[model samples]
Target: MRADRLVSLVLLLRQRGQLTADVLARELEVSTRTVLRDIEALSAAGVPVYAERGRHGGFSLLPGFRTELTGLNHDEALALLTAGSGRGERVFGLGSALASAMRKVVDALPESHLTAANDAAQRFLFDPETDLLSRRLDVEEVPKETMVEVRQAVLAGHKLRLRYASRGQAPRRCVVDPIGLVTVRDKGYLLATEAGTDRTFRMSRVLEAYELPEPAQRPDNVDLERVWAERCAQFLSEGHIAVQVRVNPARRDQLLDMAEAVRAETPDADGWLRLEVTFQDLWHAEWAMWQLDTDAESLAPPELRSALHQRARAVADRYRDRP
Candidate 1:
């Protein structure tokens, strides 16, 4: 492990030219003292590493220093190819690029590991868009150019002029600072800030986008995963309607997904589950229960139960005469 970390330290300096000890330690997940010791060791070993004192100075290597450690191992190559194969259909308009990269990876693998990696990669299949019933998940499709534009703005750290489609309203135009792009379950979302307020936009609802020359106003040290988690938690904490239900054990996972939180649970004698769950709203609660069909029963908030009853009755009445 020390050997690998040393090699990584060299690679980072080579690729990025110069870095402070604190930055290097953070990148390598080590202490600043450890980074200093590594630097001394590399210098003693004639690697031409040197440090400069005072603020605005860190560590650097003599220009043109290089290493020969760019090859990916069999497992790494296989992981890339497998991910490429699975996400080929939704790669932000980079399907061709991914295919070309995969080919290069396969060609670079050693003869001994080639066949085994290929077989391993082919054994796993991922197609989340198609459910067990063979029904395709309904998702809005974003134009390739729109996705590309949003990506460029985010990468370039530039302001973006966006025309967005809001539900039940006309498409509105606004200028926002593009922070990042993320894909969840094949659906894309852009996290940005509008007028200094955090906002998240569905990529498919983006009618058009133009990258601006002006730079975006955002913090330099942004942790995207942390930001995304915070946004998700905030969204999940509001506007929930609590209810109780009795459902088949088999559909517990589906119920959990629909509910914001599960407050309590009790196992029924007949193997059904009685759960106190909170859904986003009355309509949402009704919709999820209806989908469970005979396998579940909604048991609280007379209004939700009443809505479900009316919906079920309407369906039964429609089929009473048998088409």
Candidate 2:
């Protein structure tokens, strides 16, 4: 870990030219005393580093000093660049560090590989602001202070006290042991436990967070993927509506795309597709069916069919008066 910190220290100086001991300490997540010790170690190892002694003095590297990094080929360099697309970085409070590391990675590549790799990587875009339909993507705003405290607690194995604001409920204070942080579809959630029960808290709903001094009450090793999957399955099982529908051939794929689960799919006698779909609730089913217009017909659920019929009649009545 110290080796990695030393390497990062060198990279920071190489990229930014000069930084004070306090700045270096904060960036490296170490104390100012530790930073000074690392500076001494670097100088002892023949690195061209020196400190200026004045009110505005700090640490600096000798002019034209650059450390050579290896182990990354042309494609690998480009892959690293493409992966750091700047989306989801702010959730964990690593936006600035990611940007700086990207710059260092680009600089470390060979001269022959730099231009070609950058050109190839520029052709790929990740998490664009707008979709193909020209609709703007929704990005949740989480307070930076809250995100930092939550992340620190998780990484340092400490307990957290959260002021959580659930929908239709007043803010409540709860103490939780943070198991991990999961990001789904550009949204962040804190997977934690309270009183030996698993719970998921959306980062957006966290009104305030405080890191407690006590260690987290959790197992040493956790399978985050399994936990997330179990939570998702439990969520889908409760408060969901199952609807059977016959969709026209042209819109069958669109209907499937809108559904969370497709229990069965078969071709009907009239060449239409019969799909057993699951939605979050009745409103979700109705909105999805409305998007399909006449291409979809609700077959089994009489209540859903009635609701759609009523909506159609109301629309027709309003238009008739206009004409």
Candidate 3:
């Protein structure tokens, strides 16, 4: 290692009260002269490293010096790098910007920790996939400009004028006070407070949005986490399908991993696990059943089972019609 680089490493260890020139030289794979030069560089840069020469001697930092997030051990460095990658676009916002920040953090870590950090990255990957038999719950990416404005408005306690579209009606305009934003697997949504009542809006339903000039007067006691839970409960009550499935016990994890909102039930004597999953809609439930093939059976909610049967018959009917 270069003299300057070795010096930086020594200072990092010394800040943690683990400073020994001989140990730092071995750690850096360099000689004592290189280590000494590094100590000089640190002194030049105003990082205090006091050395005591004797049988019990090492090094220590100057008293009363504190730096936020410094002197990270190997595990701490690995954890920080791993957490940075998973934040992706929500906390960091999408694309190259988040990737650049992650790269900078990884670059700052010691060379010895690089392999562990790389392994951590490789172990976790983000991919969102839905089964073919399930109705595709399509989610649109909120424009980056809109996302930024929404975040700011929510933080600044401002109201927003939004153009919204429902499934069966033409787009309409309304003014709402921004509450918070929630990000599900691949989807993002906004929760807004209305003048008369509290309600949440999906960002995907927004056709257009503009920050209103009026002040946002929301209740000071507004609990965002509670609001999120309430909205989720409402979605499950009206927009969800209650699906019960009898699954082979060995295939439980595989099936649960494939579907969202799946709750495993007690296993029967036959070792088959029963499951109840909340589907976005009936079509989504039916599609998930199709993905499991014969390994699972949809029990409750006759409509879902019937839909699955009808879809299977249609495939057979197509071939029959060909003749």
Evaluation by lDDT, superior candidate among 2 and 3 = 2
Q: What residue pairs are clashing in model 3? A: 133-287, 134-287, 135-284
The clash count of every prediction, one per candidate, is 0, 0, 3
Candidate 3 on 1-323: residue-level lDDT in tens?
A: 36446444644563456567787776555687877777777778787667888887876777654433346676777666666654344541344345444544554555567667677667765443344445454446677767766777877878998888876799998889887777776567788877767667777777787877677877766777888888777766776777889998766766665565765577777888888877777777787778888889999899888888898898888888552
Candidate 1 residue pairs in clash (backbone atoms < 3 Å):
none
Candidate models: Cα lDDT each: 0.81, 0.86, 0.69
lDDT of 1 by residue, 1-323 (tens): 67666767776776577899999998777899999999988888899888888898889988877533247677876777678776565656665445444545554566557677778888878666676757576565788888878989999999999999975699999999988888876778899999999998988889999999999998876888989888777666676788999999998877886677787999999999999998879998999898898999988989999999899899889889865
Q: What TM-score, computed on C-alpha atoms, does each candidate reach?
A: 0.69, 0.75, 0.61
lDDT of 1 at 81: 62
| Model 3 misplaced stretches (Cα beyond 4 Å) | 1-73, 90-140, 167-169, 249-260, 320-323
Give the distance in Å from residue 225's predicted Cα in candidate 2 to where it truly belongs: 0.9
Candidate 2 has its poorest 10 consecutive residues by lDDT at 88-97
For candidate 2, give the lDDT of residue 155.
Answer: 95
